[model samples]
Target: GRNEKISAEARDAILARGEELGQALAERLPEVEQLLAMPGADQIEVGKKLRGQAQPLIDEHYRTVLRLKPRLAPIKAAVFPLKRNHDQLVATAKEVRRRLQLGSEMRTVYDDTGAIGKLYRRQDEIGTPFCITVDFDTIGQGKDPALAGTVTVRDRDTMAQERVPIAELESYLRDKLRG
Candidate 1:
């Protein structure tokens, strides 16, 4: 059976707990402390280690998707308008993508070639870490006025989503990539 999907906050908490445990162990063992202070695995080694990590998600023997984490994913984020017919949404998506790319190392793309599902599947297959969807709420046209300036961020692995303010998107994604 598939594992229960966890939210970003939950994952962060779990990581923090693990770090605490590792630190406690390090304090009791000198060797562990030295290892903890040492640098991490090199990019090539990490790449080689993660080479076989990419997985395909299958659903009902019909749909399949490639999975990757930020470390392995070339494209970090994907921006898309809720509907191609909506001029404002399309413009917002483009603007969001532009903002995400300016002076940043993040690789972002604006996609509207087909339905949202198909677009998501393409991103998943290509190992995109996250997807940002600009919808009516983001443009202040939806029922919720408070959701303006926020986009829906979807995690490709867990398929979990959260509403994130556009202003903090870059930092948010950067932190995720680091971890």
Candidate 2:
């Protein structure tokens, strides 16, 4: 499925560019030719020199194209129960994850173990953009009755928390992820 999803033409283009770079380097650098003429010549120094010379090219490519690569994004979002001790919180979190799966093809992870902070860090390490925590407020056990049927949505980058109603969670997430 992964291979089917990847564009063969794009891969070929990348390979072609790499070949061009190698040819250009071999032509411009006399040391490369000398290394080829000699027996058992180490290419490590050549590699380092090439890397040094190609730094600008690599940076430009990453800035203009490679930064947008979707494969870099491992997880779209992670769903978490505030505490594993509570059955209702765990159920709500699972339901939220299920609903997210139904809404989009985005990857979602359900984590229920460890403290909420550690879970958030784990999701962050995986490059998860958002985290939905189903806490007591999600099921009307909070100080504010208005928070019922709402989950605490945390942004991975900013570490900002916002209460989002469960009904609008799917569209809300889709909108945030669109750009």
Candidate 3:
């Protein structure tokens, strides 16, 4: 849903900007026939001067394009929760990787012995810089599993884990990914 919304917003902004630019260019440089064969050649000369002066306006418009369409830009960050079930985690991870455009192939390990260690190894093999494991601690505190609001994020390179609240997952991932 986020991906779809972002893409739509980006496309609309780009199309609107393109239309504006096209209109400006058409007004500035009319068809060659219109410019050379029109009755008022003197007016054409004035139009050319006016168009030259509008160049600055075009530049200004381009500068503010980001403000008009922010969703289409490259993602600044991403967050993923590693579920216990191998299939679920793999599926979720694949989706996150796809959404982030990471371009890495997904790999799975069948052995549960030292699973966390295996995950760390896989992360290194795939060049993933960070991994987050959603475990019992995340859903603890005598709360319902559905109500759990915490996750354990691990740095692939450092093998360090940190407890982060689920509510901050997006921003947290954004910051880590940006880094």
Name the best candidate (by lDDT). 1
Best-fitting candidate, scored by TM-score: 1
Residue 173, candidate 3: alpha-carbon lDDT: 64
| Candidate 2 lDDT for residue 78 | 88
Off by over 4 Å in 1: 1-62
Worst 10 residues of 1 by lDDT: 51-60
Model 1, 1-179: lDDT tens digits are 11135444544444454345455542334433332333331122322222222112112123455666686788899999999999999999999999998949888999999988788888888889899999999999999999999999998887899999999988898988998
Clash counts for all predictions: 0, 0, 0
**Considering TM-score, which of the candidate structures 1 and 3 is the better prediction for this target?**
1
Q: Write the per-residue lDDT of candidate 3 for residues 1-179, one digit (tens) a residue.
A: 12332345554444344345456563543332233333332233343443455544543333221111112223222244345465554454444445434432222222223456455554455455555555554545335565365666676545578876755655666666545
* Model 2: per-residue Cα lDDT over 82-177, one tens digit each: 889898988889999999987788788899878887787677666778889998889899888889999989986667999999999988887788
True-structure lDDT of candidate 1:
0.73
Model 3 residue 63 lDDT score = 28
